[model samples]
Target: MSLRKKIADSEAVLNWVARRIAGYARRVYRNTKWQRVGFEELDRLADAGEPVVVVLWHQRLVMSPFLYPLDKGRICTITSAARAGSMVGRVQHLLGMDTIAMSSHKRHVALSREVLAMTKQGVSIGIAADGPRGPERVLSTVPLIWARTTGKRVFCMTYSVKHGREASSWDRMLLPRVWGNEGVFLCKEWPHQVPRKATEEQTEELRLSLEVAMNDLTAEADRMVGRAPWEPRAK
Candidate 1:
């Protein structure tokens, strides 16, 4: 094979191996305790037969799969173009989810359309708001835009782990130890119909509201895990 082909092949092999390891670690060492608090709030919306956009922090993806039902309708989770995201997509698929690869810079328009398509087809949309890269816990406008365009409500999902492993990466990636306490926080449905001609203040207000909703749900999860409001790591 050519040198470039050889490199690509090797990288794919490495990714497969890494995903296997992560999968094993999750099965053998990770403890996932899923608690449903106010899940009815989310369920009521889903039961309404309306499209919804789900948002969470990038680093908390580890615990997200547990927040959702294993048999829930397919969700379109946003992922990175990186190999790690490819591995994550494989894992998510194994967990019975559908995913879409996206890049903050290059795939914006394409991903936006993909999300819209999913919504129109009655699939739920999932986003790691502080994802693909991040300024941690900060909100991104992509999901907001998708919600506004599709007339979908934005629902914030937050998770906390009582026992888990942490990576030093941005978003402080987490790996819950087996039987670790996991809590899911859901916010009431919120309108995302900001007009294309919305005022600067109106846009900022919407962004601020999203941030607060995320922080609120995150805080509640931490409380469920008995952590102080100031704790940094997932444990």
Candidate 2:
């Protein structure tokens, strides 16, 4: 009955409405003709009860929920504590994913711990390598670190649409066009592994390798959809 309580209730209702609208938009946009490359490999790994760290660029987040089969198992991803993060978490939940709230700007020890635990339980973790904020497509070493720590493989995947719009955000976020042709490419697992005592230089090397592999897969996906590779604008 208090004024503050009433305002909080109204805000909660508004947030729920916003999330519903966003989810509806996603469903509409992603109702496309989809082609998958390398999904059988993912299926094989999952059938063998192997954990994986699913890695993708931040810009490609739009279509990611549709890339994997929900029957595989639960996927855990990290989000921030911001309002936007909350909305994203809700959207992901609707897509059958679990989210951990953590800021990318700070130390990720807790996030790593939780993700590692999830992987140990045979639950795959999905990460937007250059996300939360991005220099778009630049690789982050978090996925590699999780793979090393959990003894899991890193599966790099990316997708492109034949017809879509790109948001002018920091990541040039891809917005799919309904009924367009969409192509998804999944790369083979990274061959190299980071040891528990991996040096900073070694970690950097792994990061660079991941970046190249992800970019190559993304480019191939674009080509499959008859689109050119995405070129980032000059800073």
Candidate 3:
């Protein structure tokens, strides 16, 4: 067999194993004792068939599959075009979530169209606001852009675990311990409606507001778990 083909096969096997492990993790997370706050508010929106662009910090991405309201409807998230993004997307798929494969630096228009269409179909869009690559908790304009284009409310959610490890990565990604006490905080939907023709200044204002809301929720979650507020590693 050729060296390239052998390498490809090895990678395929590794990805398969990773997916299976992640699937088990998802099951464990689902069965974890998670204490939720403000879920009713989010449920009310779901019950009313109102689509939302769910935003959270990149650090919280690890708990996404279990944290989101998957029972309400389909949830879609954007994944980058890189190899790691592909692997992450596969894991997300294994957890019954859909992924849009695109990068922040390319094919944004296509990404926007897909997100808008999904929201229109009542699929809640999930975004690690500082993801695909990030300056940690800094918010990306993608969610705001989607909200403005689709006129959907953007909701922020965050969580922390009493027993977990923090990765030595850019986002200090949280790895929830099995059977850990997870504290989830879902903020109320953003009150303002983003106009389709929102100006740059208006969009910046909204983005900053979202960044604060997400950080606040993160802090609240950590406090509930008796942990200090999570700080992203300095780049």
- Which one is best on TM-score? 3
Work out the TM-score per prediction. 0.80, 0.85, 0.86
Instruction: Identify the superior model by lDDT, candidate 2 or candidate 3.
Output: 3
**lDDT for residue 20 in candidate 2, whole number 0-100:** 76
- Model 2 residue pairs with clashes: none
Per-residue alpha-carbon lDDT of model 3 for 86-146, expressed as tens digits? 7667788788889888865667677777787888788888788988779888888878877
Query: What C-alpha lDDT do the candidate models reach, one value each?
Result: 0.68, 0.75, 0.76
Q: Is candidate 1 or candidate 3 better by TM-score?
A: 3
lDDT computed for candidate 1: 0.68
* Model 1 steric clash pairs: 29-178, 30-177, 30-178, 31-177, 31-178, 31-179, 31-180
- Please tell me which predicted candidate would have the highest lDDT against the true structure: 3
RMSD of 1: 4.1
TM-score head-to-head 2 vs 3, winner: 3
Model 2, 85: alpha-carbon shift in Å? Answer: 3.0
